[model samples]
Structures are given as C-alpha cells and as structure tokens.
Target: MVVQKSPQRAVLWGCGPQGSEVTVYVLGPTTQKKQTSVSNETGMWRVMLDPIEAGGPYNITAASTNPTNESVTLVDVLFGDVWLCSGQSNMYFQVSQIFNASKELALASKYPHVRIFMADLVQSETELPDLANVSIPWSVPNEKDLAPFSAVCWLFGRYLYQILKYPIGLVESCWGGSAVEAWSSPTALKKCGLDYMDEKLMGPHANSILWNSMIHPLLNMTIQGAIWYQGEANTNYHKDLYNCSFPAMIDDWRTAFHEGSGGQSAIDFPFGFVQLSTDIKNSTDDGFSDIRWHQTADFGFVPNFRMKKTFMAVAMDLPDSTSPFGTIHPRDKQDVAYRLTLGAQVVAYNHILTCNGPFPFLILPDKMYVYIIFDQELAVTPSKDIFEICCSASVSLCGPRSNWVSAPIKLWVQRTIQLSTELCPQSEEVAAVRYAWRDWPCDFKACPVYSAKTALPAPPFIINFQSSSGWKRRHIATDNYLSTEDDWQKMQNGFL
Candidate 1:
C-alpha cells in the first residue's frame, strides 16, 4: 500500500483488536518507527510516521499486543503524493480504451514508482466511515494492472513523475454516467436548493449517493490535490445550476478532506479539471457550450475570485466524432492529461510558466473597425473566422441566440486582431462579440486561436458592449455591466 506523502508527514492506519497496543516498524530509506494503541471503542489505530523522502520501496510491519500476538506485514510499500481522481464516464474511461493502448500498456512497467488504486462502484444513502470495497488495491504499474486504470489519471501521474522524479499514487473513485449531484454532498447540494431525498433522485444519479460511498470512505487518507473530468453528465440535467453546484462541490471537498485528514490535506489545495469536450458534431444544441461556460463560473477562465487555487484544461478543440465508446468519449487522452499537467506545474508546484491560453482583456470598437485585444501574443491560424458578432440596429432586438454574423479577421498584430465593421453591413451596430462559441468549434488541435508560446487553445468566451461616448463592457450571461474605465485601469494596474 501507499501512504500519502506531504512536505514532511505521512499517515498509516488500519483497524485492529480493540484496546490492543500496535507497534509499527518502517524498514527503508532513513528508517523511522512509531507505536500507537488501538482504540477500545472503534478498534481502529493510526500511526503518524516521521518525515521520509519521496523514493521508497519500503516494508512495513504491524504487530499487535493481542492474545494471539496478531501481526501483519506490508511489502513494497511506497510514500508519495496521492491524487484523487473522480468524475463520471469520461474519468472512468480506461487506459486500454484510449488510443495506442498497446504501447501505453507496454510502457507501464517503466513507472515502477507510480501506484494506482480503484474504488469499487458502490452507493449509500448516508456517508460511509470506510470503503465497502476496493476494486484494485495499491499496486505498482504493470500491463495487467494498468490496463483498467483511469487513462487521464495514469497519464497525469506519469507526466508528474517524469518531472518530479518521485513516486505518484493515484486513487480513482468514479462512476460511469454519474451526475455531479451524485458525488456532491447533501450540504453542497442544499446550497443550490437541491434535495438529496427528492423523489426524482435515485440510483446512480441520486444526490450524494456516490459521495457517501465512493468519496466519504477515503476522506481519512491525505491527498495532494485532485483532477476532474466531468460536466458532461451535468449538461443534460440542471445545466443552469452547474455554475453554483460545481464550485460548491469543490469547496466542500476541500473542507471535508482537510478536516477528515486531521489537517494533513491542505484546505486550499490546487485543483485541476478538464473542461467539457465536444459531443454530437452535427448537433447545434447549446447544452455543451453552456456547461463549458458554467464550468468556470461563467468567468471564461479559472483561478478567479469565485474559484481559487484551481486550473482548467480546455477540451472543446479535441472532438472525436467517431469512436467505439461513442463520440462523447474522445480517444485522445494524452493531450488532455498533458494540458492538465501544465496547469498543475504552475498552480500546484509554484512553477513559472505560461499555463493558460490568451484571454481577451480589452475590446475597443472604433468607427470603421473593432479591435479585440488579448492578454497575450496572438497565434492566429489560417484566419479568425470562428469569431462572430451580434449585428442588430437596436440592443433590444439583439438576443444572445440570434443575429450573429461571422466577422472575419481583417488585420492581426502583436496582441490585437482587427475586424472591419463593414462585415456587419446589414446592421447599424454590433452589440456583442464571441469566439469559438459552438459545441464543436474546430477539429482536433485545429482551433484558429492559441497561445503563441504555449500552444494552449484559447477557451471560448463572449463579451457584450454598450454604445456610448466610449464602449462599456457587459457580462455575457448576466447582462450586467462589468466595470467602468476606472475599473479597467485597475485591472491593468493589477488591482483586480
């Protein structure tokens, strides 16, 4: 088994005979041992071992002072950063189901220090103290053991190990086709006016059922952070409420883990999540796009005021129209994991790097041309045809869902793209501008806009503008004014 490794702490725990004394022996690099007695009431014992280095192929022995002198030994134990991986079907997608499965399986043996564990699919009406079952116990990576592991999780750990050169443990607790409410606790759901006991909620989609069984049981174990690949299920149910429920679930998990681990887990640990990828290439439903926006609390980027210590991996550019597992399940998980690792490097490890794509910070509408200014340098592909503008003579007639005309890129500079007003000649004015707004905006890695240096695809966004002496930015979803020129100046001065 693997014990979660923090900066200078590790926890080893188990159940034993009540009121019995348990002695633990650590035999590995920089040997250190601890002893603690089992609780008479709960028959449980935990030993907080001394600080140990990352690399470990250690052995641990637990001997109890019971009538029979019961003893157990754990072989090939490891100490490393354990990351919880959870979500719905996308996260449950197995390593064997991804592209180049055979090659990935063959390379599993190379990662001897990396370990994986998968929790059994179980649900309970109430929170559980311990896991009912474990599908795959802590095991080193190998062809047989790695095949069924979460693809995104494995790739993420592999990437991290290559950089940190330390042991990486991944715990996966996911259910296929499970809704976000299923993993969210009742306390979190209540914040969004959702009832776990609602008559319509039951089975895999029941509120808090999976959280009670799959997540609650593992709360005692300390973790470094988590990576999520969900939101596809939420696109179908309570899509509008996702912006509220998703952030609430994240906050609740962070608090629960910190308390459950007795403060071993950081209260504000870094979190990374994959934005909803594309589904149904031919369909025009706004469900996917809407969920994507809400995934980031409608802010179009993460690590904002609403969500702190978080990172996002945009996946709309990775669309798989044909797959045996269905178009919803994309086959290429390498890029997804790669993108997540980039964010983790910056957010979790405090590395200095460009982790996000260019975002539009300012938009100016001139007489005959409108200029869109980005936060970073531009890398415009063939052309910027993905951008669209709402062309309506009056703001009252301009709805978010209608009167959008393609605005081709007329001129491109260092960090700004110029568009001619003549493109929308049919209307007296352009009320709003949006980019990559469709469900499947482009083919895999073919998005027109990207970071010039990092190659990270620019996430989708919509910005509304009001006509006056000067343009005033408006929130896309809420239709509220964002700020005045003074606030924009503060943003430029790093006050926001």
Candidate 2:
C-alpha cells in the first residue's frame, strides 16, 4: 500500500480496538516511528509520521497494545501522490475494453511503483463513516490488476509517473449510467436549489447515494487532485442544470476532503475532467452539445471564474463507431489520457507549455465577410466547412426553420480565417455564427481546425451579433482589416 506524502509529512491510519495504543514502525532507506491511541468512541486511529523522502520500498509494521495483542505488517510500501478518479460509465470503462488490450496488459509490470485501489459499488441513504466494502485493496500494477481497472485512470497515472519518475497511487470509485446528482452531496445540491429528495429515484443512479457510500468513505485519505469523466447521463435528464450542479459538486468535494483529512488535502486542489465526446453521426439533437458547453460553465474553457484551478480535455473530435460496447463508448482512451496529462502538467506541476488548442479571441463581421481571429496559430486540414451563420436579422427568428446556411472559408491566414457571407441571402443580414455545433462534427482526430503547435482540436462555440454597431465599433477600435494582397501572399506562401 502507498500513502500520500506531502513535502514534510505522511499519514498512516486504520481501525482498532477502543483506547488501544498503536505503534507504527517504518523501515527502509530511512527509519522512523510513531505512536497513537485509537479513539474510545469511534475506534479509529491515525498516526502522522515525521519527515520522509519520496522514494521508498519501506516496510510498515503496526502493533496494538490490547489484550489480543494483534499486529499487521505491510510490505513494499511507498510514499507518493494519491489521486481519486470518479464519474459515470465512461470512467468505469475497464482497461481490457480499450484499444490493444493485450499489449497494454503485458506492459503493466513496467510500472511497479504505481499502485491501484478500487472501492466496491454501493449506495446508501446516509453518509458512511468508513468504507463498507473494498473490491480491490491497494496493490502494485500487474496483468491481473490492470485488466479490470479503469483504462483512463491507469493511463493517466502512467503518463504522470513517466514524467515525474516517482510513485503514484490511484483510487477508482465510479458507477455506470449514474447522473451528476448521484455523486453530489446534499450540501452541494442545496446550494443549487435541488435539495429535495425524489423517492422515485433509487439504486445506483439516485441522488446523493453514491456520494454517501463510495466517496464519503475515502475522504480521510489525502490526495493530490481528482479527475472526472461523466455528464453523458446528465444529457438525458437535468441537461440545463449541469452548469450549476457540476461546479457545486466540485466545490463541495474540495471542502469535504480538506476538512475530512484534517487539512491534509489542499483546499483549492487542482481538478481535471474529460469533456463529453461524440455520440451519433448526422443526428440533429442538441443534448450532447448542450452538455459539453455546460461542462465548462458555458465558458467553453476551464479555469474560468466558476471553476478555478481546473483543467479540461476536449474529446469532440474523437468519434468511435465500431466499438463492441456501442457507439457511445469510445475505445480510444489513449488520446484522452494524453490530453488530460498535458493539462495536469500545466495546472498541477506548474509546467511551462501550451496545453490547449485555438480558441476564438475575437469575432468581427463586415459588409462582405466575417473574420474569426483565434488565440493561437491555426491549422486547417482540407477545407473548413462546418461553420454556420444565421441570416435571420433577429435572434427570435433564428431557428431550424430560419436561414442558417453553411458559410464556407474564403481566406486562411495566420491566426485568422475569413468566412464568406455571400452564402446568406442578400435581403437578410448575418445575425450570428457558430462552429461545429452538432452532436458529431467529424471523424477521429480529423477536425478541420487545430492548433499548429499543440495539434489539439478547437472546442465548439457560438457567437451572437446583437447589433451592427456593436461589431462595427470593435472592428474600428481594433483596426484588424485583413483584406490585402500581402495577407493573401502570406497565405499562399504556406506561412500559416
């Protein structure tokens, strides 16, 4: 078993007889010892060890001074960073379900310092003081242990281990087909004005049940951060309330863990999550797209005002149609993990790098064209064709029945794209513009727009033009006119 270690200390804890004196000994590269007494009422004991280095293959021995004189010894122990991974079905997807399962399982032995633990799936009406069941205790990575564990969780920890070259401990607690409310605490729900319990909602998908059983029990364990892979179930129900409930849940978890661990866990720990991927091809439903936007609190990016110290991985470009589990369950988790790891390096480890793709920094529309300026250098594969412009001249008139026609790309230059407004009827005016606003926009990693440096896909977004003067004033203020022979020459010379 591996315990989470901070820069100066580590904690060891367990249950024992009431009022019994417990002694713990650490023997490895360095030696240390500590003693504590079990709580008379709660029968719980915790010992905070002295300062210790990160690397270890230590032996920990715990003995109690009770009548029974019971003792336990743990071998091959290490001190490192611990991370909790939880969410719905996508997070519950096993390692064997990913692409090239055989090859991944065979490579598990190479990461002996990375340990894993999985809590059993259960639910309760009230919060649990301790875990009722443990499916898999803390164990080093092996073919048997890696096959049944979460593929995304394993791959993420593996990537971090490779970069940090230290021990990593991952704990998995997730359920399939569970909604966001199921994992949210009552305090969080009440903050969102959704505290009332629905009796009809029961079982693994009910409100606050999974939080009580699965998450509450593990709050005592210190962790560096958390990563989530959910929101698919929320797309079917409570689709509009995600922006409120999701951020509330994240805040509540941070507070609970900080208090539960006696301030061992950071109050503002870094949080990372995977945005909802593609669902169906050629489907016009807006449920998946809505959830994706709400996942970031409608900001289309993380580390926003509502969600601080958070990072996100864009998965809209990855579409899986040949999975045995179904089209909804994508098999390529390698790319998802890789993208998430990049976010972690920047957010958690303070690494200096580009972690995200191009995002719209400014949208300027003129009489003949609309110029979309991105924050980063743009790279286009084939021609950009998924952009749509509203030609209704008013917000209320814009809908499926209105004039929302495809606006093709006319000119491409560094950090800017010229969208032709000629496709719209001359009688109508372009009122709004949106990009990749469908359930499934493109094939696997084939999205037309990307970052030239990072190769990450641009997230989908929509921009509205309230009035002609609003855009015209900004265009004149910024002085970003790009209709020149020099700009065209730069484009033709492959400078973008």
Candidate 3:
C-alpha cells in the first residue's frame, strides 16, 4: 500500500524587519531549496507551496543578509498536527518535577510523532512588533531534551500521538507569572477596548508579543488545532475581559495562519481550552462565575467563527490543595493531560467511550415536557427492586427504602411511573425527584452511596449530599420533576 504523503507548506513571519534578505531552505526527502525574500513592512511574511511537496524528517534553516550575516536552524521538522500550547506556570511546569516523569522517560524517550518548540519567557512594557532575538528551533521530544517541558504539554502530546498516530508538533510559548493579557495580541486588546481596562497603556502586549516571538514564525507550518490551559494569570476576576478577549486571540491566530496559497484555510481551527478550576477562592466575585459561565457560553455562539469550533476542559474538580496558596505553579500535569486528551479524543477522533472519557456534554432541554430527557441514552436490566419513585417518604415498593432511585422508563411507555409509583406519597404531588444528588467527587469516591452494595438501576444524576426532607403537596411542571416549592416544603414541613 502506498503511503499518503503529509501536506507540506512553509511559513515565515516577522522576517522583514529582522533583516532585508532571508533565504529559506527546505531539506527533507529532497535537496534543499533556497528562497530570497525581504521581511514585509508589517514584519510578518508567509509563503505556502502551491502543491505541498514531499514529507519526511525535514530541516528548515533560515539565513539573513539584510545588512549582516545571521542564521537559524529548525531540525527534525515534519509536516503534521502542530499545536501551540500556552498558559500560565501550570502549562510551563517542568517534567522532572512530576512523580515518575523520569521512569516514564523510556516511553517518552523517542517521540517520533511529537516535537516541541519553545519560546523563552520574556515580557516587555512595549509590544514589540518584530521580535528580533527569537532564538529557538523545533526539536523532537525526549526525556533528555528540554529539562522541563510543560508537564501538561508532554502528556497532551503523548496522548495526541497515541490517538491520531500522526506527527504532533507543539509550540510552548508560556510564562510562569503572566496573565491572559500578556499572552493576547494588541489587536485583540485594542478591539476589547477600555470598556474593560484603559488597556491603551497596559504592561505588555503579551498575546501579540508571544505570537510575534513564539507563534508567528511557526505559522509558516501546518497544524491541526490548539490546546490551551490558561486563565490563572488573569485571576483578577477579569473573566469577562478574558471570555471576550480570549476568543479574539484564536481569531487573530487563525487570521495570521491562513491556509490558502499564501493564507491559512478560512476554516476556524478547533481550539480547546481548560477551565481555570476553582483555584481562585472567590469564583463568585466580579461575577467571576458569571464570567466563566459567559466564557463557556461563548464557546458555540454567533458571528464569531472562532468560538463555534472550540471546547472547554473542566478543571472544577481538580484539587486546589495540589499547590500551596500564593504558589503560582500547580503540578497536576497528569490530569491536565488526561483532560486535554479526552477533549482531543472527541475533537480529533470522535471517540466517545464514557461520560468522562471526553467530549461529554450536558444537553439542556428546551422545556421539561412530559418526556424525560436522559443526558445519555442508557440501557438497563429490569428487576423488581431496580429503582423507586419518591416524593416525601422513603418509598420502596420492591426493595428497602433506598437513598438513591432510578426509575427504568421503558421506551415509548406511557406509564406515569416506571418503577413502582407506590409509597411515593401522592404520585402526582411529587414536586421533584433526584437520582444521585451530591458532589461524590468524580475521583476517589465516585461510587454512589447506596449503589455500591446493590445493583444500581441507573447511572447517578444530580449528586445528593444530605438525607431526605419532606415536602407538602405542591404542583410541579408537566415534566413531574421537582419544583422549588418542594425544597421549601422540606423545611416548612419539618422533614429536614
């Protein structure tokens, strides 16, 4: 079987101002070819081969002759899925700091499909349009390589390699103590305007500067998508600025890396980001929660082509204690990788295995009609004591009164109650019903409280924490789900 050659292209950005004449060489599966071009006025210049040439272990070397002699080398280059991994210290954490990163070194020793390109962490008061001293090259990942590549990035790349089985290139342009604005471009900031901050004169145009130094140059390459793990920097509760500003960066990069003859494909690349988690003490402050909620809300919204193609990795469950207070670095890279990998699995492979397996989404029903909406269509084995329906009392028709209940509703069944509706106080009076209503930590103690000893009739739903409460007769929506009054009744009826 003839192997399909990977797509080939070249990208050169911020070359004009850095020098007058720069010759690029493409050496892989063929003799190196040279091209002479001056960095454009914008300091951003790009070129794409009309017909992508051969692919292999390639080398891209750049030499400048603007006024002096300068040279740069990028080795072990290959045409593949190159992703730009950016964030705070979490994404910049060293691999050696992890538990068995060294022991796992053997497995990570040879990364044929994975390569890493790093940008030195640098920030300036002025947004430098053309970063002249960006000295870094792309190299294959190995334990002996960079002392500490981003821990999250390492696992993420490894996971992507295993899943796609394609060459994965990563560009890590992150800083240990930087905010979202530091990584965003001025274009985006300017667009965001002072409606938020007098950003006209902020610290540094981090995003734009980073793109200039770290990402802009690589835009000459081919990439599948990007995975982001940031927001800790902008923890000033500017989540609104972030939610709005972050998407713009995605758009800016897409615009910068157009995939056409000399432009990137107009297609908005899939951009997946990790939620900052509850690390911030007051997520409710500054409408931080709302900010995150809105940030999340924008994922698939309107005229913005950037958001429709994105996903959010939930870190709400991650341990905040992992890192000490005032500590900028959080070292739960394994889970970060796991989370991003799961997301990529869904984004890249469409491989859905479990609710937590990745790509798990909560589908909000338009209205709670008579029909019950199962977030996931699950199958169950019928049993006499399979589950129960409860309103006020601990009603058990087939088995002992249980804390959790799952009524097996047969497909197309018109029955008001699936499991025995008896002992449910007034069946129609039942204001609301809950399955597993507790934050039973998705990790460690994820097993349901009562279901562990007995065969569970259904998967847990809204996790419950405390014992039952009473509810006087109250009307519920036609869906028969619990109404707010039930909660009030439980307290007023002295059933707490």
Q: Which wins on lDDT, candidate 1 or candidate 3?
A: 1
Find the 10 residues in a row with the least total lDDT in model 1. Answer: 487-496
Q: What lDDT is reached at residue 43 by model 2?
A: 89
Estimate, for each residue in 1-496, the C-alpha lDDT of model 1 and write its tens digit. Answer: 6677647367677888788889999898768778999888877898877767677778899998864488888899888888999998889999999999999999999998888999999999888878999989989889998899999999999999999888899999999988889999988999998864658757888899999999998878888999998988887799999999999999999999888777888899889999989888766787888889889998899888899999999999998877799989999999999999999999999999988998887776644666777888979875556888877766666655777878778877667777766677653678777888878889989998898888899999877677644654543334455446775555434421
TM-score of 1: 0.91
Q: How does candidate 2 score on lDDT?
A: 0.84
Q: 2 or 3, which is superior by TM-score? A: 2
Q: What digit string (tens of lDDT, one per residue) describes model 2 on residues 100-194?
A: 99999899999998899999998898999888899889998899978989999999999999999989999999998999999999999998887
Models, CA RMSD each: 4.0, 3.8, 10.6
Off by over 4 Å in 2: 382-385, 395-403, 466-496
Residue lDDT tens for model 3, 1-496: 0011235344444354543677777666665555666645565444443334334676667777757677777676566566768776677777777646666566776665677767676555444444445324456556666456777777788787787766677777776655666666577667776223344434333445454455554455455667777766565545557667777677776766564225443356667776654443422243333334344543322113437666555544454444543323445567667766765676555676431311112211111111233323333333333333334332232222333344443322211223333434443323234332222222321221212122212222221112223322222112233335554435333311
Each model's TM-score, in the order given?
0.91, 0.92, 0.63
Worst 10-residue lDDT window for candidate 2 reads 468-477
Residue 493 Cα positional deviation in candidate 1, in Å, after optimal superposition? 22
